[model samples]
Target: MSQAAGGVGKRIAKGSMWLSAARLVVNLSGMVSTVLLARLLVPADFGLVAIAATLMQIVTSITEMSLSQALIRLDDPTDQDFHSAWTLSMLRGVTIAVVLSASAPLVAHIYGDQRLVPIMIVLGCGAALSGLANPWLAVFQRKLVFWQEFVLSTASKMTNVIVAVAVAWYFQSYWAIVAGIVGMYAATVIASYCILPRLPRFSLASWRTLLSFSVWTSASQLVNALNWRADQLLVGKIATPTVLGYYNVGFNLANLATRETTLPLIQTLFPAFAAIKHDKPRLAAAYIRADRLLVALGVPVGVGFALVAQPMVPLFLNPKWLPAVPIIQAFAVIFGLQGIAGLVTPLGMAMGQVRLLFMRDLQVLCIRLPLMIAGAVIWGVPGLVAARVLTGLYQIAIAMLLAKRLAGVSLMRQLRTHLPTLISCCAMALAVWWVAGTGWRLFAGYDLAQDLVLRVMVGGIVYIGARVILWIVMGRPEGLEREAANMVGKLRRRPA
Candidate 1:
């Protein structure tokens, strides 16, 4: 790499740090607020609000296709680019907001719930303002100024929690929940306005150029919206609205860890990767490096949560939501593989293979929707979750191919990087199951607490010991050879 390119790499690395930390802070806050909100509101309230949000989501997904990734791929966008993009966003904002606000009564009429009209209107306002945000946020990302975007995103999300939770505490109604929604978009607009760069005048050339992608991207958004929210609609239309609430809450909660961790990686690294598409070797290295890092992070977190879902769920949500427990666990396990998909999606677009990526998602949605509907009819919420989990396995194979073909990183190389991670997940699952089977009861007398502590201690020792041994045996822990050798010496000194 040249000195200039090396500087970009270093800066990308630094920016990745800021972006990752911002995601961590924001997601953690959002998770806490979810727990609190679940406690404060009734299932009906959550259900009602969820329906409105899902309806808005179906719409929001349709409209959001134009901005981020398209801008990322453009090499050297001009002021005309900015002017046209900003105009596109503003126009979408007004159109979507009005459509949502107006459709409220119709939605209420369909769902037979008169209360949803105002809620949908509020959500529509949020949708409207969301379209008004930093077209330059994309520019910030394009320039590898991911940290600036990170700061704006994090601060905006925190505002959502503060406004939503405070209002919920006093009002204890769905409107307070709506306030949280309002606060989030309000924060987005305010932060983007303050931090993103000033725009140039609206230019006809730029308008025409961006319009090409804007239209297709919007179409992409619609397809994605339907495919993404298919489960919510199926569950709501077929199952009880309350069941849909439980289903969405559980699904979103389960996905939080993967979504939070991997999203920033995509946002930061896709632009970074796009900038280096001409350099195959550099692109390959970056892809492998990112794949390894993501697998290491995502797999363990997902599996560990899956294993420990019992205590984790009730600890966060009320027991009334116990039904969501198994569903959440299934999702966490499936989503853990999402890190692999994360590497694929951006690598695809970076290499101009996004059409393939879209086609793959299109396929998944086609299979997944019918199965999800069948599952909702038969298995109810868990069936919907099972369909989602099933999608992951098929997608992983496609992700592997994309990794190899697009980035020149072989599928074997990618799997080799994650072999230990796979082992670690299995270890966590086995340890949790063994400990759980031993009936380490903890809700009883003092004995229960003592038994619980013992279970955790033993489970940790066994799980970690197995992973360390496998890591050594597989020759994947060469980087930790010195530490392993020292541990061997210490073990030899013991009374055996």
Candidate 2:
């Protein structure tokens, strides 16, 4: 391997650790928040907050500087690059906050929920803070400072929980929970500046250097952000806030599996994909490997969740959230399929296949938007859940085609690579399902039949051991052992 190649492997190692650590931190934080808010507040409270946050999300996303992306993607970004990015960020942040604050009441009126205005304005502060964050945090990620990212992610979220819970308990209103989001993000912005080795300052000259780099990424990210949140939009319009709240909870849990699994793939595989950007052969191999890993990681995890969806939801989010169980299972399966097509999006993005990436999303939108609308109209909550799963399969089909066309990741390559993981996951799911006697027997308010704990434990351990045996026996996954060893080195480097 060349120095850059070695760097790519090391970076992947670091990204994996950082993302995994971040996932754990975020999940724990998310779990805590979900429990507290669910116990203290009702779906209606979550519903009120969701509408404001969703609109604010649109603002934050559209106004994004993509400074981090600009810095990381540029072949030779400079200090000036960092400075310009930060300047652009701060201006945008301030602008969004002011606009949002002014428009919050109007937004709430349009949504037919006047109470949402204050929450919208409250969350708007985060828009400004995010925009003002030191753009050099990208460099931390670029430099693979995984541990710092890990600590900061955990700490910031823990802060959010502490504040949110304290205020919610004292006031017994949803405002405290809403404000917690804004406060935590502000905290994160400050923490990022402190932790980053070289913080970027405001500079016009630096701004000029980064514009071209920032524009495309910013557009892509903006569109992507909108795309991700569209389901919420559909639900909010067609269903009641209480109904949308269930949808959000369902979506959240689904993401916990897919997002947790592929989160590292995006960061780690990007550098690797960037390296082999010019080589079709290497790119093809890389995509297949990534696809296989995604399947291996996602399939079992998703399947496990689907198996235990009923039990897990009640235990995690309270009985009031039972409506979310079906939706969560639906999305879990969707994400599982998408997981198998993971490389298509990143590989497409990295290889200047922006048009392909956009088109694929467009195709997904084409399939999803209409279906989502129709489903929301017809089935209401259940329709929402089915629409998500159906649309996901539609997108996955398109994703596979794009991977085939762009990266030459063939049908056989995908099948051959995924067969073992798929089989193992299926076998385990069946075992769990069988043991649960089809998840049918109810004990008290919950089903006691699904032995989620035992099923997941035995299945996961067996599947993982099988994968390890295969990886070693076949001498496959070109960099498998090296990556494992690299992970060990990273763990050793962590502070006591």
True-structure lDDT of candidate 1? 0.74
Q: Best TM-score goes to which candidate?
A: 1
- Candidate 2 per-residue C-alpha lDDT over 1-496 given as tens digits, one digit per residue, 9 for 90 to 100: 4687677767777778787878777887777887787787777777777777777777777776556666777887777777787788889888878888899888777778888777767677777776766666776666655666676777678878888888888887878778788778877887777786566676878665566655555566566666677778777777788888887877877887666766766666765676688989877876776776677677777877777787677776688899988878888877876787677766866676665576566566667777877887887767766777777777677777788888887777667777777666767767666766654432554343345565666667766666677677766555444478679999999999
Off by over 4 Å in 2: 2-4, 197-199, 206-209, 438-450, 461-496
Clashes of 1: 0
**Candidate 1, 446-467: lDDT as tens digits:** 5534544554565567656776
C-alpha RMSD by candidate, in order: 4.5, 4.5
Residue 119, model 2: Cα distance from true site in angstroms = 0.8
Q: For candidate 2, list the clashing residue pairs, or say none.
A: 84-206, 84-207
Q: Given candidate 1, what's the lDDT at residue 463? A: 57
